[model samples]
Target chain A: MRVQAAIEVAAPPETIWELVSDPARYLHFMSGITRWEIAGEHARGLGARYRTLMRVGSAEIGGLVEIVECDAPRDLAWTSISGIDQRGRWRLREIGPGHLGERTRVELRLQYGVAGAGILGWIAEQVAAPAVRKNLRRSLQELRRQVEHEQARAAAATRRAAARN
Target chain B: MQAQTARASSGDGHAADGDPFARDFDEHEAGERPPAQPRRGPLERLVDAAATVIRGRVPAADLDERDPDFIRESLPAQWLLASLWFRGEVRGLGHVPEHGPVLLVGNHSGGNMTPDTLVFTLAFSTYFGVERRFYQLAHNLVLSWPGLGFLRKYGIVAASPDNAERALSSGAAVLVYPGGDHEVHRPSWERNRVSFDGRRGFVRLALEHDVPIVPVVAIGGQETALFLSRGEGLARRLMLDRLLRVKVLPISIAAPWGLNVGDGLGHIPLPAKITIEVLPAIHLREQFGAQPDVDEVYAHVTATMQETLDALAAERRLPIVG
Candidate 1:
């Protein structure tokens, strides 16, 4: 099944990419994520691998996933290397004309299922769609909240620094 | 769960019924069998012939029979049963060793239809991908039952020391429930208890294999039906222990069969919320001594499991709603 969730963030795509690309920040902003560990030497960019697990229903479902597409500040995608078959992507787009840095639209899409599992697999995917979608939506809201809050904090710090100077 | 029947196969060309493990463990535990009543009637002969056929159907333990592809394909059905039907929640799977052979000792519950096993199997399979060689020990009866041949594909072999040793020798994790049919058919009021009935063969198995033992505690299965008794007396009088190698003829009040007896045909288990907790692995040689005492290890394991079961039981405010 395919599930996607989108939200508008005040910061630019680079800011969102910074948070999403760093494996360390996953547990903080990603809902239902139980484990997110760097599997190999490389941490980010193409070829980087991660052992990820997400709590869906009664099981922690995920596996080793490699970064197949990493377009820096715009798009990031990964496909499963083992465990459940999955393909996940993070898309970031400037919200409006000439307001690229001021606002951005972020979407997290995931396509996951057990290949060759037949009718029951199809049914299970349908049944698990709502939970997966909810987690994605919450994760986006959390990402927006953290990024916007960080930007506000940085702006306040800059104002205080200027006044002190 | 008292599927204490020993290895059905002696690895010889002879019939499995003549196997020593089946006779030694099954009959020794049940005591002396009563004298033969009379000559078999026509109905009795037919039933005997059918039993003989079923007994012949039990397959020999072949580690290669465990097909990871088949297990992966069947996981969805198991997941639906565990997630929707049982509403299972499993915690602390990380406590189990991530790799290598280890013994998983669990308390069995939920008569003939073991929902606990179903929930735990799904959780284990999903947690540690199907690629890992994970096997479960089941009673010969369960293995010989018609249409359950697919269970072999799920990596379940007849409960026997040789089978377990073989699985472990192959560096695969093996799950065993010492309580077996005895504790599984316990009265509903005693659901919170972890009664292994002094069977410490699992301790010996782990010690022999030189592997760690992981205790798996679960609750809410006994709530699936109103279990009345294990019916040991009836089984003794009927000589089921000697004839079929079955110790108990359980009686319960369950769905479709209001006054279910024997439960050989199984029954519909109520939608009980099952919660399983996997305790940390106990390296016997390290924790106990270089020469660990079987009795001590058994006591420690049972105590630890009972404590966890108590905590799970206390958290429950109701029976099947659990």
Candidate 2:
């Protein structure tokens, strides 16, 4: 099953990049992306791997994954080589100006393979497409909300701090 | 007579026009002529003609100077949408106490610095009925427009420790966007992407002023504005791109990027709604001089801001805007 969902992030790409590209900060922003620990010694850059598990409703699905690409604040893409037939990519493209803040068009693309590689794969793709798309959409939106809220909080702190100085 | 009987508009009124239904008929008091049934039009019979003239036909430019929302909504709201528009589902607005001077410290994105500030100001004014001016500690460039006209007009002083002290000292509700330039271009969507290295400004100011910090979490506001790609070098050929504080991209990214000055900022902003939740006021008394570790206070406040944001995202419906 292949599905894609994106969220218009008011945050700058750099802000989103800090949260999404860092393997350690996954739990800090994303909602259902659980079980992100190192698979090896490397923590950042390409070829670094992480054992990952994502929560889908009541079910938990994951596999060992390796980073194929990592471009800070711009692109982070990965493929599942050992898990339950999973593929994930996080892409940040400048989409135009945002409504309230600056907007970064965040596209999260995922492809899932069913048990069979042929007809059954097609069936599974249809069945899982909506579910996975919905999940990814919600997750990206969650990430957006978290960053912007933090942005506001940071602003307040700056104001207060500036006051003292 | 108009001055003696004239009433200052009360509450957050829409406008001063009397309801047409409020027309009265009482010409018999001064004349042998029977009074005309007070038709809702101009009655040569009364003294409120001035009020009526000031009513529906009132010019937006003439609105009370302190209440800018009227002028904003009346004349500029539509035009403002031509560039960018925002719709925030403000939650926990009541957490902002209406009693005394309160300091609102919040996270701000570099791509869209002023969104959170504007939304917070509207929410506060709408709920509190006071035209509370949120003193913004803006950058020097934003104030130095042309010859610093905009700043002088709107009363935005530079962001400094002294300005913060002055605003808080005057018992006014002030707001600050602390992320500065770095936070603006940071990671795309991470909430805790980066920390303010020397971020003790708010904490120190609050402790010094003895004011409570009202922590606000503006979630998903950054989804609307975007920074496509940064240039290879920070060239210093200053112009409008730098003036507007947006990077000059070689390629167009945002929806309205190619549009002109009057085009409706195209619907690139997905329907993801914005939810602004006001968390409990964080008190500085316990650790002002007690904790002694400014780093500890910064970490604590930062964590709280993140926690509040996460909770809101998990619990509330996501937002969608212009």
Candidate 3:
């Protein structure tokens, strides 16, 4: 089953990219994720690995996933290496600077299927897809909130620095 | 006189407008105001008022009204004992999620008077604050005592499926000792062992609630008293199990009480200098398959706790002194 969600964050794409790329900070902004920790020495970008546990209904489904694609400030993707078979991607696009603020459209997509359960897998997916979509939406909303907050803080700090100078 | 008349007319108009009963009265002056819907009994009204007050004081769904105040008052003394006398060291508290429900599974030690339980409860309530809704599941007998209203106030509920479910549903971190009295009363020589008496209800609870299971491993509790035997056969012969739901009738050497049998009444717990290590959380469905085997989950949790306990034991050069 595939589930996706997007949000228009009032921040630059680079700001959203910085937050999403770091594995350590994933727990802070990811919804319905019970665990997301670095599984190996590599921390970020391609080749980095993470052990993730995502809550699906009354169960947590996840495994060791490795970064398969990393396009800085634009896109990042990962593929499952063991446990549950899955792929997840994060896409950020600049929606052009507006009079109100700079807006970035952030989209998260997850494609997952149980490796060995066959018909049971299909049934489980059918039951869990809606929940997964809701989780995705919540995750995106949290991401937007975090990115916007970070951007605002950064802008305020920059202004302070300029004033000090 | 004209202004007073106008004001009186307006007042009457406002009264008629505000009261629907008055409108009905005007429509049917003959019909008596529908008998004030049977007034609730005084006892029921008082009960409702008390419930409202309790709910306001204790916002958590399953917590007792006096829990926050009791924990605050007891924390200072418990902290002093934990830090100074017991030299209790807590680690990996960061592994606990900042929010949401979680199951804290640990091996229970130190017969009836568990210093480890006290130390952990103090540390947890201190770290998370009393408002975060944390409950410790204890045997029904523990909560049965009349004077232990203090225990209830500190969110110690009787270990039952219903109680556990209520705590979890309320998004409280529930600390459970699957070992129960059996492991706590094990011979002191077997202090390093992490035994749950093969209880797997904790795993089922975690799976049912879909919460992360954080294994809490503590050593030195068993060293508080010199446990001679579990006396399971004795308890069985005496029918204590059937009569009181008491599984273990432990014979232990302790201060004051030379030989303690069925230390359910509790004894003076020697300060054993407990060290608790909280292990990383394990999601059952994630580690194992979606339909994970209960035995497998139990084994995984106990093994992890055992390994950590062994490591902590290795660090202690002397018993009780640790």
Candidate 4:
């Protein structure tokens, strides 16, 4: 099953990138993910792994997933190494200046397939599709909220500094 | 830290010159006619989202749902008794997972007034905090008692596959006594023994849910009373198993009620200095093969618990002392 969601954040691409680039911050934005922790010593960049557990209906599906692709301020993708078979990607695009100025468009895509269960796997995928889509949309919404909130705080701080000087 | 200091200063209409951002923020704040509402950070937002998800996913009828206020209110009394009266000492709590579903299998002791259950429950809830989901499976009759709303509030649920499944599905740490009434009512002479009465349901529950099994071995509960026998024959002849789902009609000697039979009405529990030790989690797929045999898993769990119980028993210098 494949699920995709996107949200436009009123913040600079660099501002948004600061959050999405850090694998540890995924827990702050990811929805339906019960557990997301760095698997080993490597914290960032390609080949970094995370021990992830996703809520699928009544049960939790867990796996060790590694970063397969990573491009700062642009794209990040990961594929499962063990347990459940799955892949996900995050794409960030600078959508130019908007009403709020310096806008960034963030998109998330997830594709997953259950292995070896045959008919049961297909049924689970079908059942899980809606939840996966909901999670994707919620995740993007959360990402946008965090990026915009940070931008507001930074802007306010900058204003205060100018006034004091 | 910088932001926090800046915010604190700005609230007082003063900005520290050390931070350039603090100066401009103060002017922006002063220029605004209306006070700005405090903005919740990403961490706070994430916590709210998680709480919402848990509330929505966990069923209203879920037996494992905990009332934080009630648990908090009862903690003082329970803790005092556990520490002062029983001298209850719990070890190996680190073996339990900080999060995620887990099955805690332990031997039931002290018949109807199982102090082991109380001590462990109090300790577990206190350590994990009341917000974390936890459930203790008990016989249906226990839940049938009137005016015991406190039990249900504390996440005591009727022992059944559905209840267990619901609790696990909701990602609760479920504590199950596979031995049930039979093990709890065992003769006083078998105090040091680890007995689950050959029940293997707990093994299947862990495998089916793919949760780690945490073994909790407790001693000294049997010393709470002088148990004569499990009264299995009496229970069988009376068809108590079929009617009440009670497998034992225990005979025990206790104050107020000497030669207490059935212990259905409850008895005052002797402060036997209960000691509970939790062992490392046993992952079924890792320990046993993927397609693990039920008997082998059962034996492994029971044997491990027995070994730990024997060790704890050996450490005791005298009855009700340690």
Residue-by-residue lDDT tens digits, candidate 2, B1-322: 0000001121102222342111111111123223445664343324244334323232221112333333223212221221134545455655766566677777664242345544555455434433455465554334333433332323354454545556677677767655543344344445323334344566656666778888767665445545433331332233222223322222213455642121112225432345566777877776555444556766887788878777766775543432
Candidate 4: regions farther than 4 A off:
A1-165, B1-61
For A61-157, candidate 3 gives per-residue lDDT tens digits of 5768999999999999999876456899999999998875888899999998754445545665666688789989998988887777777898899
- For model 1, residues B63-175, the per-residue Cα lDDT tens digits are 89999888888888888888999899999999999989999999988998888888888888877888889989887778777777888887888887668778999999998
Candidate 2 backbone overlaps, count: 68
lDDT of each: 0.85, 0.53, 0.72, 0.73
Docking class of 4: incorrect
Model 2 misplaced regions, further than 4 Å? A1-165, B1-85, B110-113, B146-155, B191-198, B228-252, B258-272, B287-292, B315-322
Docking quality (DockQ) of candidate 2: 0.01
Docking category of candidate 1: medium
Models ranked on lDDT? 1, 4, 3, 2
* Segments in model 1 whose C-alpha atoms lie over 4 Å from true places: A96-101, B1-55
Task: Please say which candidate is ahead in lDDT: 1 or 3.
Answer: 1
Identify the CAPRI category of the predicted complex in candidate 2: incorrect
- Predicted complexes: DockQ each: 0.68, 0.01, 0.01, 0.01
Q: Which segments of model 3 are wrong by more than 4 Å?
A: A1-165, B1-62
